[model samples]
Target: MKRKHTYKLILFSAFLAVVGCGNQEKKEVAQAPPPSIPIIQLTTKTVTGFKEYPTNIEGVINSDVRAKTAGYIQKVLVDEGQKVKKGQVLFKLETQALSEDAGAAKARVNVAQVEVDKLVPLVEKNIISSVQLETAKANLAQAKANYSSIAANIGYATIRSQVDGHVGRINFREGALISPNDATPLTTVSDIKQVYAFFSLNETEYLDFLEHAEGKSLEEKLSNYAEVNLILANGSLYSEKGQIQTSSGQINQNTGTVSFRAVFDNPNQLLTNGNSGKIQIPTVYENHIVIPQEATFEQQGNIMVFKLQEGNKITTAMIEVKAAIDHLYVVESGLQKGDKIVMSGVGKLRNDMAITPQEVPFEKAVKPIAKLFRN
Candidate 1:
């Protein structure tokens, strides 16, 4: 009986030992190692930042065609976008009525001359007073002046191009009445050999731009300004780059913006009076620190990144971004060269969390991921 009782106690001890070992194994499996996170050290790079502003292109000379005298349009001599020369007749007004009036005026002048001649002969023969001859001469002068005025009106009926360029949209067709007082123009003519790009910036941006430009005077600053690029509405870049020329020099009180002008050569007449595009101005930063935009996350409206610290820990850092270049950001403040930051998994990180840092080359970390998927 004593031996059987000892055997039962040994069996119970064995069962307990097996259960404790299983529990220890399970606990060890649940305690996983800290996750490895990719990290990169910040480094300076020469990057170009682009700022685009919507602009409308205009020919260097845009002239509105209007009738100087009221008349019905008898002809439209040119089509839209047609090239024309100065003094080319664009429209010929119906001058039948003016012609009739001019003929009547000429007949009156002839009749008045006959009367003046009759009075002069009668005065010479002492058959009429000198005052009567003078009156007849005055009447003859009035009729001649009237005839000359009517002839001038006949010439004014022909509408001609005042400039050398391409014709724009014709506002009126044949038989449409055009007047000098009309609000709408007959058509527009544009000299498109070179184009002007008009763009605007807010007061704040204008001030910031002037502050960065290196020159003592506005003219010198404009001359020193970097060349700009034009992006067409169809998303194609223009062949020729443009230069910043003039500025309005005053803020528009109603819009709170300042206007700027840029000039571009349009050799092919590709640009017109009202072509729209975007002006892309590049801001170059030489040897400035840059980091991957993906490595950053917004917290409480501030841009932040997970900084790698001692003991392989990460803490949230606030960084001031000056501009974006491709998929990277140009750092202005709050970060410097030689600072280690988590390259990825920033979304899943918490403040002061321990991590396994997998250091990567700065160039590899900031490689534009967007370009990788391009066809």
Candidate 2:
């Protein structure tokens, strides 16, 4: 009877211990805290997507100054970067040899004229035949032509500016032998009152532009195109906007790109030939849903965002991104305007994970990119 009572007591104690462990496990599960995360309600707004292409800048007129005649440069009238007017002499070549040749030719011309005069009187008296007088006249004409040709060569010794613009580098200085056949020009002149920014788009991009751009003809489409912004080399936006000037109209077989040119007024002469930057062309999206890029993630080649359900449970919602600009994504579909999405901490959140709801303003979620939509 004593053994039976001890066995019963031991069984009772083991049963109580099992019951106590089960109750403790239940309490720990109940007290566990849900993850806290910020959420934002989506809104419909106008969003603009921008595509930037590298650009090469040039002045309205870039003229290369070259020597018209072969001679040694006697004087350089203007320095590089000097503002010059049309017909202004920029260089003077050594013409002493040309001058001597001209003198000799003139003497020949005078001697020919005297012979023609003497021959005309002799032919009138029949002292010489008419053919001899004709021959003398022809010699006079040839000598006179030689004199005019030498005079023209002397005139070419002065190099002048063909247009009113700023001078570029002086490749040849005083005493430098220059000729028309020289590979390099004496200088370059650029008219920077207006400048052109040349850029290119790939074949696919050009086709897309042509499809979405408004108007029936290419000219009309370009005319109706929106003004583009320029990002300078130093990462600053230009104050004035530029207009689409022209395009190559054909794709380059080698580069597979269609070239485009945009014109901008440069009253201050700030932009010059060889300047480089980027051309930002904006495509405006009206009444479209946009979201912060940070709020989304890529899964299995698809972009997704976490959305909060009724029980504060987050679920992965697949979103189609039409375009991404800066830090924002232009959402095409898969998200409604009133739906709430996780503002951040997306990487930490899992599908169907319960979270403590911390609502935040939509502007606060995407404040970094607020300026991109402004007109």
Candidate 3:
């Protein structure tokens, strides 16, 4: 019985030793140092915002080249993309039939003139009545008019450019029958020294644009508007600036949008008719509070950040974002200048959590991340 009591006492003492070691480990863990976290002070930054819309580019003057008289195309003098001046012939039509008719008309005019000459002499000699002379003179005038008409048509058989521009595709090559009544033009002449970009704004956008401009009249508002930039199809910005204009304020019934035009100089011929691109309009914010997007997390669809407090503890801040500039958010409200916030590791943090605050420069923390998506 004494041996049994001795064994029980030994087992109880061993259990106490294990419990005391665990208590010592618990106290050490509870007294350990807090985690170090990088923090940044909030600052306002100047940011530019852009609104982009798809646009259709066209030459300021897109003239269609068409034949005035019906005939087979005899010659195409110029090639596609050939630069030509006004009055230069583009295509020649087969005029053999018209020339033959013109020769007959000329002969008739000569015959009428001979008859009028004979009648004049006979009238002077009192052998013919004055009414007969008048009748013969009328025939001569009619014949001359018919010959002139035929000659004018022969001239029109050679299609000439009415504008100084570059030639487009030769739709009807040599030997193709083309007429003035044909649906398609023989070619198109585009004056691309200056280009026009056309875009549209919906009803709400149109009203908002006009409402923001500081002018009583639409003309004044457009004149006071800021210059717009073009984003080429290749995603590069065009080198030239453009001015906006609108002829009518009336919205289209079919499209339900207001049309806007921007004119740009194309000295290098980078832009041409049928080209496509985007128009970018800018709105500038002078000074606004900004925070790195990494510093914020979404909670219940609201953007949130951890703001540092006096006790080395952080509290959740719900920021009102004005615009998202790259990887940063422009704060509209909720966060003010001089407020310090956690710079990183927000995913591991909770509200009112204590941390060893490590100060980080405001620009140093955001610039590199912000530059990743900049234009």
Candidate 4:
């Protein structure tokens, strides 16, 4: 009988231990805290999108200073980067050979004139035929023409600036033989008071620009187009804005792009020929939903965000991004105004996860990119 009582006691003790362990597990489950996450409410705002394209700068007029007549360079009058005016002498070529030829021709002209004078007297005295006198006069005219031609060549030896601008590198120094048929020029001069920024757009982009651009005709559209900003190679904005001047009507066969030219006034002469930069064109979108780029994450090929649902449960929401400017995105679809999305700790949240929603002001979420939305 005593052994049966001890067995009953052991069974009761095991049942009590099991009940205590179950209660402990329930207490631990009650004490667990929900994941904390910062959330932002979406809103519609006016935003402007900017698109940048590579650009190359050129002077309004680029004139090549070349040799008109073949000769050796005697002296380089102007140095590189010198500001010169029209008709300023830039180079002097050796004219010794041309001068010698002119002297010989002048002597021949004198001889021919003497013959003509002698023949006229003979003809009047009936010592020579009138046709012979006429032939002597023709010879004198021919000799004078030869001398004039040689003198003109000698004049061509002096090279002058064709326009008022800055001079470029002088290719031929003193004693360098230059020729009219030579491939390279002696130097270059560029008129840079007003500069041209050249850029290209592909076929698709060109068509889009034409469609969105204001006006019925291409010329009218270009005239009505807004001014664009230029970013220099050193990553600074150009002070003056540029206007679109014109575009190539046809596409380039090799590049599949149409070229565009924009003009900018350079009163200080800061921009020069052969400069490179980027052109920023602005497009405005009204009443568009904008979001911080940090609030969204990429999943597979689609962009996603964790949206706060009823009962503090979070669900993955896919968003369609129309354009990305700076650290913000202009959303096209898949999100609506007043919808709340997790702003921080987006990586820690999973689908249907419960979270303690820490409501953050929408302005605070996108404060870093507020300036980018300016018109």
Candidate 5:
């Protein structure tokens, strides 16, 4: 009887132990993590305003250096990729024919002067007829005119650079015959000390920027801003600032963009013609709301950002974006002062979800990464 009672007690105790183990397992499973969503606190602060426009790097002055007179090139004084100054002689032409023609013209001028002197004395003394004296005077004038023309032609035989610039691509060699209207350019000269940025903006962009632009001349509704910047091909920002100069009056019917130009002081001569890059411009003028790019989400052709409300619960809101002002999106509508905004972990977020919200510092929220992507 004692042995049977001990067996029954052991069985009862074993059943209680199993029930306790099952209860402990159930408690652990219930305590696992809920869907944690990243929450950002929104604050009303002054946002920086900006708008970027597509631009290209261009030469301040581009010229095709050509010869003025026809001749065989006697000597090429400069080579390709050489720097030249204004009025620098680039090449010498075979001037034997030109020089001889000039000498003959001078001799004719001397003979005409002698005839004029003899005729003047005869006319004064009434020894010669008036008609004969007039004829001699006319011949003297014609000879002088011919002499000047030939002298000018001789001067044009030497090729000189018209601008201060870097020379490019020599097309002719020594002893090569060149003409005034040859299809091949002998060389090219480009002044890159200050580069011109050629670009265009539509009428809508013009209207948005017109108010912020002040104290500058406006042509055809486009105005020059006091400052500009250049982005290089290797994704570098030019240190110098440029100013807008002018714009063409008519819009290009095919592209629907008006032509404009800006001049940037390129002291290092780093920018060259045909270089492609971007231009950032300040377009809107106002104290507006801005949110971090991470906080914003795109859904169904509309941009939505989550705002934290009472009890740390998130609520969905739609915002009207004016432009991406720097690293932040400048908000036009649908947000107010003192609204709590979520900054990071936006990809794992949804509407009406509860979160353990914490306020991050403003600098940490607005600070942008150095990586640049074309807008």
Candidate 6:
């Protein structure tokens, strides 16, 4: 019975050893390495500084057409949106009353002239007093002046355009009684061949801009003088360049912003009166340290970046953001050109964390992981 139990135990032990060996063989097959978390190393390159601000486009020339005298409109010469020249007759007024008044004054002047002529012969013959002849002459002169004034009123009845531009809608149609001081405008003519962009800048920004302008090299200053661009209402860029034309005499105390007017050519007539768009004015360029926006992080109201050190350790460096350009941030301080900053996985990283940084494309490192999963 003992010998049988020993044989049974040996058999059980052999079975357990075989099972253990099979498990060891499975463990010996090397597992595939864990998937790598892609990362990017920071490198220095030339960066263009940009200032992002909202702006609008406006017409350089705009005028309201109004009636010069009160009268009933007789005829509308030009239709709305038609091109008109300066001094072109846009509307004619019913001048029947004005003409009749002028004719009546002319008849009175003729009668006065006859009396003056008759008195002139009498005064030469000394049959009448010189004072009477002089008085007759004065009466004739006053009557002629009244006739001339009446005729001038007749001329004011016709309303003409004061500028060369596209005519706006006609406010008063034929037979409508239009007044010179009416609340609504008669029409509007705008010279859309050129447009003006009006903008206001605060005193602080103005001083900084002036200082930058003065400190720049002559070539750079001249290059930036007329280097403003405009994005129109329909999201198209205006082909023409604009320049600073004039400014308001005094700074507005209430707003502390100085108003300025800039003029630009709009030969295509794409710009209209009161049309709004963005105006990109060039602020002076300076040598500033900048980094890609993907590499920057914000912590407790402080801007921070992960800088690589000698031991592949990421050191968090705080930065002062001067401005945000296209896809980057301009740093005022706390950075050097070749600091080898870790530009990816910033949220998961801590100060002095050991990282194995492989130089990866910035575009791929910044891509959303969910987007990759979807693809």
TM-score of each: 0.88, 0.91, 0.92, 0.90, 0.77, 0.81
Give model 4's clash tally: 0
lDDT tens digits, residues 1-375, model 2? 999999999999999999999999999998988978999999987877789999999989999999888999999999988999999999999999999999999999999999999988889999879999899899999999999998988999988999999998899898999999999999999999989999999999999989988999889889999999999999889888999978888999999999999999998888888889999999999988888998999999999999989888999999998888778888989999999999888998899999998999987877765466643
How do the residues 168-287 of candidate 6 rate in per-residue lDDT, one tens digit apiece?
777889989988779888889878888778877788866666666643643454345546777777778778877766667357999898776778887778777767877776543355
Candidate 2 global lDDT: 0.92
lDDT of 5 by residue, 98-145 (tens): 888888888988998898888888888999888887888888888889
Order of the predicted models by TM-score, top scorer first = 3, 2, 4, 1, 6, 5
Model 3 C-alpha lDDT versus the unseen true structure: 0.91
Best of the two (1, 5) by TM-score: 1
Candidate 1 clash figure, as a count: 0
Name the Cα RMSD for model 1: 2.9
Residue pairs that clash (backbone atoms under 3 angstroms), model 5: 40-341, 40-342, 41-341, 42-340, 42-341
Per-candidate local distance difference test: 0.91, 0.92, 0.91, 0.91, 0.78, 0.75
Candidate 1, pairs of clashing residues: none
Question: Taking the tens digit of each residue's C-alpha lDDT, what string does model 3 give over 29-135?
Answer: 99998899999998888888788889999989989998888999899999999999999999999999999999999999999999998888889999979999999
Q: Write the per-residue lDDT of candidate 4 for residues 281-333, one digit (tens) a residue.
A: 88888899989898889999999998889999999989899998778899999
Q: Comparing 3 and 5 by TM-score, which wins? A: 3
In lDDT terms, how accurate is model 5? 0.78
Candidate 2, position 95, lDDT:
98
lDDT of 1: 0.91
Q: Pick the candidate with the highest TM-score.
A: 3
Cα-based RMSD of the predictions, in order?
2.9, 3.5, 2.4, 3.6, 4.9, 5.4
Number of clashing pairs per prediction, in order? 0, 0, 0, 0, 5, 3
Q: TM-score of the candidate numbered 6?
A: 0.81
